[model samples]
Target: MTKITIPLDNPTLDDVARHADVSPATVSRFMNNPSIVSERSKRKIEESIRELSYVPHAAARTLASKKSRMIGVVVPSLDDALFGHFLELFHSHISTEGYTTVVASSGYSSDEEHIQITQMVSHGVDALLLVGLARDESVYSLLNKKKIPYAITWATDDLGEHSCVGFSNHDAAVKITEYLMDLGHRQFAMISGTLKGNDRASNRLQGVRDALARRELSLPDELVIEGPIGIEHGQKAFKLLMSRSPRPTVIVCGADPLAYGAIFESKVLGVEVPQDVSITGFDDTWLAAHLTPSLTTLRTPQQQMSLLSAEYLIAKLKGEDVDVPPTLGVDLVVRESCSSPA
Candidate 1:
């Protein structure tokens, strides 16, 4: 076997073109699709590449293919486990197909979401994975203009006509509430994530209201408190809810981190969970099951979402047809945190 000599310096496509005595565009075509180039040029370019050890620029080659093979994911926040789980599963799935995920946190801001999306598009992401379906019309318009494919995960919109995976936040909230109501809970309060510019949080609040309305019960303006996703905010919201005379028999949280805050705050206040009051949360995070009183929460189909999202985008890239489920389902995981009010 003959050993090959190594080049001291990196050789670019132009160097290969020069060595091959061909145009740079011809070298590019040879690199991207050898079938498009003449046999003589292809043979010369291959020989030149071997002699110079010329490496094709990945970005330039991808540009020629019109596929970055990168999927952009923008979530409300990267700090939350709900999004973390979704991403973990998503990465595991999407990576198998030779796609890389570039993640960004919107910090629960619509404007930030738009900015992240635009930046991803500018960077040549082949597709996008967003958390929810509700965003500015301009965002959708921009995506349309760019001809970029996208999938919405975690929340579904019936009228949006967008590719979506995951369950209905509104329906899940209703189920959680109905579960508590079935447990003989009447007085209710909610600690929800910030509603503005977030369809997931707003739909959860509306779900609770709809559930309450079904039983001739109502969530007064004071019964619901909106704050950002965090344990600290949940604690503050829980404290405020508990301070009122005759504490609400049940408190439903929009996400598990918020529930964690509520439960910890309840312990601080010397309130017995499910005895003095019941608590339920969304996004059945790992911490939920390990809490002092394990949380009753919704087990979002994160793996399913991840799988479907990857499949959907891969199909789009392959020019294959795929059937996206109208709406995915979620499981209501009952635990020690909720029971009939005494």
Candidate 2:
């Protein structure tokens, strides 16, 4: 028998059927169970399949069986050690349940997160865990449509409809700032992660603003600088804030890295921490206590959030009814970094 020539390099089922001179159903039947098809048809179908290289999706069955056993996670960033520690506990929990994690860092872009999550779903993730609840609505819609179990993390208020497990950024910030206010600190400067596309940062910033407003003290627009949550950025922000006419008496950082930078820069600038300017951080990462003056920051329940989120998703995957956990709160840990103005 002569082989058929096809222009299309990546042919579909129809191409195989046409080349074989059989219906698409016949091709499917032959591929699924070659013994059921007549010898004549099988010969032609085999030849057509080889010539056209028509690839039938093999993963379709895996998706139907839900055997991928992979959980997808997308975080705002991986640069923060907080996420690293979070993932460590999260992966440990899920892995023990016979699931592995596939993590993606969106670099705090909502659009990128949507695209990455959609790709993960298309790739047949059994479940998902996302950071914050600030992405496109389509992301949630797609998860629902696909019936994929997911948990929205990093926020205390589940916002009524979307039940989640996380600490309140707003409340945590308020706690730290109020403590500072109680120490008679009035001048406030904040070094924050960019508020754009990041609901946590936005909420924390609002918390500071709210606390300042209540105290009859307002942070100048210039005193607050938003950038990445890295030490260098923190140092730059500290330098800039210190250069202002009336330097900040206290600096509130959105993350521990920023607070670390403020303290480091304080040393370099011949300024004393707590004595010259008080500092505080959020997401009390492990390094917070190791700093020279130590760090006063709000402790995020990373390990608890990770384990609970893992259990929540695993229960959903197993078809077990889960009690949606209430919103978690943060604790303000007083350390050497903060003191009243001298």
> Tell me, what's the RMSD of every candidate?
5.9, 10.4
lDDT of 1 by residue, 1-342 (tens): 122245638888777777778888998766544556888988888898889877666687686687777899998888877788788888888775657799999998888898999999999998898988668888888888998888888888788678888799999999998888888888999998898888999899999999989999888879889998899999999999999887899999999888999999989999899899898888888999999899999998888898888889877867777767668888999899998999
Whole-model lDDT for model 2 versus the true structure?
Answer: 0.86
In angstroms, how far off is 31's CA in candidate 1? 12
TM-score of each: 0.85, 0.81
Clashing residue pairs for model 1? none
Residue 337 of model 2, lDDT score:
90
Question: Can you write out model 2's per-residue Cα lDDT over 1-342, one digit (the tens) per residue?
Answer: 233574676788778888888888898766544557898998988888777777666576365454576899999888778899999999988876657799999988888898899899988898999998787788878989999988888985445667588878888888888999999999899999988888899899899989989979888778889998899999999999999978889999999899998889999999899999999998888999998999999988888899999989988887898876877878889999988899
C-alpha RMSD of candidate 2: 10.4
Counted clashes in each candidate structure:
0, 0
